[model samples]
Target chain A: MNKDYLNSDIKFNKEVFKTPENYFDNVKEQIYAKTIENKDGQMQSRVALWTIVKPQLSLVASFAIIFFIALFVIDKTKEITPILGTADTSSYIYTIEEGFLKTNFIDFIDPSDSSNYREEIPQDQLAEYIKDNIDIITIALLD
Target chain B: MTDRDIIDGLMNNGNRDHLFRLIVDKFSERLYWHVRKMVVYHEDANDILQNTFIKAWRSLDSFRGESGLYTWLYRIATNESLTFLKRDKIKTFFSFTDSYKNVEDRLNADPYFSGDETQKLLYKAILSLPPKQRAVFKMRYFDDMKYEEISEVLNTSVGALKASYHHAYQKIQKIIEDSV
Candidate 1:
């Protein structure tokens, strides 16, 4: 028969492991005392709670940072981007084109047609028009 | 006192400290031995056992009673032992010049260890096994722990644990044979 290596007859059993006299009792007292100390101080519990919460807190923090960065990038984009959604571009285009035509369309008109378009205005009415629109004309010129 | 009583005592806010004492009284020695066999030193085992209970006490609220209290505590003790073993292995790796001879010498020098030469050799062979495998073998062979319960404690499949124990057994047998 193969030697029963794990049998107690080998004297290599659990009995070979021993502790000091009153070790168990003393250890119990030590554990109880330490736990009681923990209860009174509550520091160990707090530290344990910190260890458990630390990783989750880091994850939350990382998300918060990403969220803020996304928010900041979005805000920057909004600052540089034009407004979106149902803007009445036809009216805006007409107004812009009207201004452009008023300033520069004379160049595109035929010289013969331009002579016909030259209706004389009364000096007094022209003066009134200039007075009424002087601020806009001055601002446009400045721009 | 029954584990139920202990659980009930821990659950009740009125007498948690008293119940914790019961817990200490109940599981300390078993946890100590479970740790002691792995580390093979009483002081290290004592420290690990204390940390295990202290950890248990701190996490009592998370215990859902899914497993028996002993199993839960055994799991904690096993994890603590493994962690200690890993840290000790790293600390000693650079300085561990003589390997198994150091283990035998350490065992021989331990005042609490009263084993004969054969027992020392057995322990030396055992300690030579990798830490986790040593734990598997000790749990099964010495503590008579069931593979299922060890699976729960180790969070390993029972098949893997059986294989690990078999391999550990073969290795220890070989080491002892060679040494003899």
Candidate 2:
């Protein structure tokens, strides 16, 4: 019985495979090159995806900007008004003229004079006196 | 990257350099032999080796980490080698010119191939077995893989693989006896 196996004459695979000279470096570089190529592709898609999405997002952002502008304009329009400012003593005084107390409302300006608000008139009567003066001034302006 | 991470990343189109390097640096020569054992030529092994890597890259996404990455890769390479062998067998079986004749011509030129009678008888005996049986024999004998490892790589049972190897060895012994 001839037990033919790795004949002593068989001349291959007697040892482990070895890397030839310069082959290991080539393998490493190839690995690196493939990696860089994959990363560059990922960066490109990120840029591309951002470009496609930004314009749509910008339209909604523009709408928010306009709403803030409208709010600021409405606030500014309510801010500056002669009636909302301090009263003008030159245009108003506690004048008893022919049973009439005259005081201007729309054109009132602030006064630095302490004589303008005297303790002689109660606050309840002050409204009636100022309203009567306003009517008299309105007639003068009309005339 | 850890080998698993690198393999996962590569499969998912993420950075694969570390894992792939490990793969090439570690398995290239071994894979070359695996392919070479079947095709029996340097150029053929080179072709199959590149293809196995490319196939691994393309299919990495489906890998579920169910098996060790090395075994998974070995599985792919082994299957590729067997597929090549089967294709060659079909072509040789059909064409009267015979594919082994071309292999014989190439092997005759190989300075490493021995021309002794016992080696010739052993070679012929290996040829007489079916492709799968020959594969089991080679994986078991030449690669010296355990039955469990062979099963992991071949997707065959250790019992079945053991049986196939036994039958192949017996056939070789019988063939050698007849030739003598």
Strongest candidate by lDDT: 1
Predictions' DockQ, in order: 0.19, 0.02
- Stretches > 4 Å off in candidate 1: A1-4, A7-12, A40-143
Query: Candidate 2: which stretches are off by over 4 Å?
Result: A1-143, B1-14, B98-102, B111-121
Candidate 2, residues B98-130, lDDT tens digits: the string is 554665565556554444555555555666677
- CAPRI tier for the interface of model 2: incorrect
Please write out the lDDT profile of model 1 over residues B1-180, one tens digit for every residue: 899877766666537777778778887887888898899888888888888888887887788777778888888889988987776665455443677667777887899888888888888888888888999998898878899978877889999999999999888777766767
**Model 2 chain B poorest ten-residue lDDT run:** B112-121
lDDT of 2 by residue, A14-118 (tens): 332233456446644543444433543111011243454466558768998998999889788767554345345423432443455564433343456567555
Alpha-carbon deviation at B32 in model 2, angstroms? 1.5
Clashing pairs in 2: A87-A109, A87-A110, A88-A109, A102-A133, A103-A133
What is the lDDT for B58 in model 2? Answer: 59
